[model samples]
Target: MQFSIAFPLAALTLLISTITAQAPGSQCGGIGWPGIMFCNPGSVCSKINDCEGLHGSLADQM
Candidate 1:
């Protein structure tokens, strides 16, 4: 019984990690003109260089 629980838990952890391992650009964040912008959750615009108020212009435009 313990082995069965451990197996499923391990499998679920692996699956979750795998799904989240994809590029951050794959999810919604911001726009970077030439490329997709990505930021951590709850991150401020100031944290990203090409994000609106951060750099004035998109990275691709610069």
Candidate 2:
């Protein structure tokens, strides 16, 4: 019984660590833009476009 519990716990820990390590976003899904604030999901703006006209500016601070 103890062996079974330990094995499952170890597996769960490994899985959690793996997921956290691979998680996205350093800030706001990694979409922080300069002079802009947020990026829209499912928008068709390329990086060459400078992420402008694709997202709204930050409120009260832009």
Best by lDDT: 1
Query: Which lDDT value does model 1 have at 28?
Result: 32
lDDT of 1 by residue, 1-62 (tens): 99989999998876675454424324333355443343333332233543433322234343
lDDT, residue 2, model 1: 100
In angstroms, how far off is 43's CA in candidate 2? 34
Instruction: Kindly provide the TM-score of model 1 when superposed on the true structure, using C-alpha atoms.
Output: 0.35
Best by TM-score: 1
Model 1 pairs whose backbones collide:
none
What does each candidate score in C-alpha RMSD?
A: 10.2, 12.0
Task: Give the whole-model CA lDDT for all candidates, comma-separated.
Answer: 0.44, 0.40
Q: In model 2, how large is the Cα lDDT of residue 18? A: 46
lDDT of 2 by residue, 1-62 (tens): 99989999998876665444321222222234443233333222223243323322234123
Number of clashing pairs per prediction, in order: 0, 0
